[model samples]
Target chain A: MTDPDEAADRRLDANAAAGPLAELFTVDLTVAVATCAGCGNDAPLAAHLLYADAPALVVRCPNCAGVVLRYASSGSTLRLDLTGARLLTVTLAADGSVGISERQPHRPP
Target chain B: MSFVSRGFAGRRRKTPPGRLPPGQYDVGDGFPVLSAGPTPRTALASWDFQVQGQVDGVRRWSRTQFQGLPRESVSVDLHCVTSWSKFDTRWEGVSVDTLLADVVTAAEFAVAFSDGGYTTNLPLADLTGGQAWVVDTYDGQPLEPEHGGPARLLVPHLYFWKSAKWVRGLTLTLEDEPGFWETFGYHNYGDPWREQRYAGD
Candidate 1:
């Protein structure tokens, strides 16, 4: 027999999980943006230009002076068009700093 | 300390290693198994991870986001308080060290809540630079959901349950907050080597 108290506890848990993060967990977003690391163009770019391979990600164009928008994907890695931007790989250093390298391929955010 | 070769590159502790196995701490203590209380079956997509208390911004990530985070590969041995050991567990996901690295908030303790709503607390210092990973894979394959697939906190240095499974989120707190098991007379900081399982058992 199911305990009434256990049933009540389940109800309370159901209510608590109905928050914003609830909806956010199931949906995956995909975004596309442009690259402007070279020539320093300030115009908006398309997603096809900046793609890299890494687990699906929300890429941010670090070269963009301001306005960081999130481009989301679910793939194991991102695909980037390294046309103008110098594809530098950045990793969290042992000391916790951004370690940039040309050896490791640039991973889109 | 005498180390016994566990047939892997790493040596096992003969005197009961002071630290826990990686990828095992995410189950939130598994304390229910020892108690007379109810053990809840965690369902898919019904789990919630909370990042609250003393955090600059309160945030929550769902199963999708948990899976979407940068995936990492780590191999670890899991040592349980019950005296069974599973070695060479392969895990994939963000490390607890990486996940909490940027948070500016300071907390003496960190409490992890699991799907069954079970909880476990650990020291802030204990979470740094260990072979811990929020494991989503086991044995180089996608972890079966029953084994905390999608995501689970991995603290290899502590008891397996400290790695809470079906992990929803982390809550940053200044106080040393205790959760379900700790409140019910389990060890506050469960170290397998020390055999710290029950309260004054």
Candidate 2:
């Protein structure tokens, strides 16, 4: 029988999975730095493992496997959940105009 | 405005009836494996499942004991958050309802902890009422480790991520504690129909 673990590694990372969200953000999400809220681990979004087999994009922390972010789109409505991220730092340009966004706990809708 | 690579253009086909969900495509045959870490090899002799946390007390079952629990065969569609949906996948396992039948608890939520430290949270309500299972087999064969062999949680209603792989035991809690993916950015209440993929959604 084929090793299932090998099959899992065949999956894509956040960088490859970010194709859809590339249009929603001004900066490249793959290049952005993300700090995990759970373990406080820091890494580029590209380093996160991305499972993009469903309706939403699921990005998990490479260090702890905690979720770093999730995004879903339905027609004109888009939902982004970053509850597990402490902060996301994006370098807007090569010139280094940095943008930092803090993730807040989700409120009941 | 979506960019479609020349290679990806031909991958999509006509949607099948009631099989495809919004923002997802059919990946006909063969289950696609996705995991956060290397697959763990747990010997069946040492494998055990537990129910801990806010429950009256922890309940444990060895590989033999778990298999002794009543089992059922289930056929359901699996929708991954990454845009792939597989229809009519079949599995056999013990239902969460049966697993919790003897345990007593007032907890409103659960955190499913797995062998390789993978965790995912779910409302207690979602685990009951025939909504979920701890499956050990897929299509009459023992589930492969990468697909959460020995046992894995199966919550078919939400995205597949919510159905944690390599599951060992569940920790019931009075307060909602976000598990692995939930802590990062995945929606806490991952309802596929609502497309609640992120924190705010």
Best by lDDT: 2
Estimate the lDDT of model 2.
Answer: 0.80
Error of 1 at B100 (Å): 1.8
Reference-based lDDT, residue B108, model 2: 95
- lDDT for position B56 in model 1: 74
Model 1 shows how many backbone clashes?
Answer: 37
The C-alpha TM-scores of every prediction are 0.50, 0.67
Candidate 1 lDDT, A2-106, residue by residue in tens: 766344222121112113222343311121123345434332222211212111111233344221222222223222223344332233447754332212322
lDDT of 1 by residue, B49-154 (tens): 5577777777665667766767778877676654556555667777777666667786777887765454678887776675566777776776655566556788
**Which stretches of candidate 1 lie above 4 Å from their native place?**
A1-109, B1-48
Q: Write one digit per residue (lDDT tens) for candidate 2, span A1-109.
A: 1746546555456777557776688666776778999999888887777767534576778777777787767657766889879999776545565443432222111
lDDT of 2 by residue, B1-201 (tens): 778698766665555686667778788775787655556789999999999998888999999999999999999988887668888889999999998998889899999999877789999999999999999999999998878898899999998899988899999999999976676567898887777776787
Q: What C-alpha lDDT values do all the predictions have?
A: 0.51, 0.80
Candidate 2 stretches with Cα past 4 Å from truth are A1-109, B1-16
For candidate 1, the TM-score is 0.50
